[model samples]
Target: MERDIGDLTIEIDRTLCIGSGSCVGLASETFEIDEQNLVRFQDETPDIDPERLKEACAVCPVDALRVYDGDEQIVP
Candidate 1:
């Protein structure tokens, strides 16, 4: 799944995700981990700082989360 939050573009690779709650735990407004432990979004525009947002994406254990700002990838 994909979502745009402020200037960041977040792409989640569901197949790669390990059901880690890191993203949701850091930015609840931007991400939610379901009962099945998959990630979902609260909204497109999350109320969070850019670096913090990137950190949320960075914390995903499987590298399932990708964050982009325009054409640049901010998170691995």
Candidate 2:
């Protein structure tokens, strides 16, 4: 799943997600864990700081979260 958050684009790869809650822990307002234990964007996400979002994505142990500034991938 992918969505535009400000000037950045966030992507969540369910197949790679291990449901560790790392991303959610870091950015609860921006991300959430589904019943299936996968990372997904929050419905009413506030204006997210790009760096915080990037950090959240980086915290994913399995690299299921991705942040893109235009065409460049900014997170692991």
Candidate 3:
């Protein structure tokens, strides 16, 4: 879906994240691997593509990636 929100928000369930790095690979500007090898947000306001974010969420090995718009609408 095409969205035009103020900004994008991404959430990762650390408990469910398997460190597969798919999200990081897809949206490196928004996602990254912490020292613990867990998925974490790279910055508070990182540049991200809505469609690529959705792709990252879709390819998450454990469904741990969630992307939301400024209106809190889930994108994938």
Please report the candidate that would top lDDT against the real structure: 2
Q: Which residue runs of candidate 2 sit more than 4 Å off their true CA positions?
A: none
Give the per-residue lDDT of model 3 (tens digit) for 1-76. 2222236655667888789998878877767789889887765534566677778767887878766766574734
Note the Cα lDDT for every prediction shown. Answer: 0.84, 0.90, 0.70
Distance from true location, Cα of 11 in model 1, Å: 0.7
Clashes of 1: 0
- TM-score for all predictions? 0.86, 0.95, 0.72
Quality of model 1 by C-alpha lDDT: 0.84
Count of clashes, each model: 0, 0, 0
Q: Please list all clashing residue pairs in model 2, or write none if there are none.
A: none
The residue-by-residue lDDT of candidate 2 on 1-76, one tens digit each, is 9999999999899999999998898899999999998888899889978888899999899999888999998887
Better of 1 and 2 by TM-score: 2
lDDT of each residue in 14-74, candidate 1, tens digit only: 8888887889888887888777788877755546898888999999999999999899987
Better-scoring candidate (lDDT), 1 or 2? 2
Model 3 quality (TM-score): 0.72
When summed lDDT is taken over every stretch of 10 residues in candidate 2, the lowest stretch is 44-53
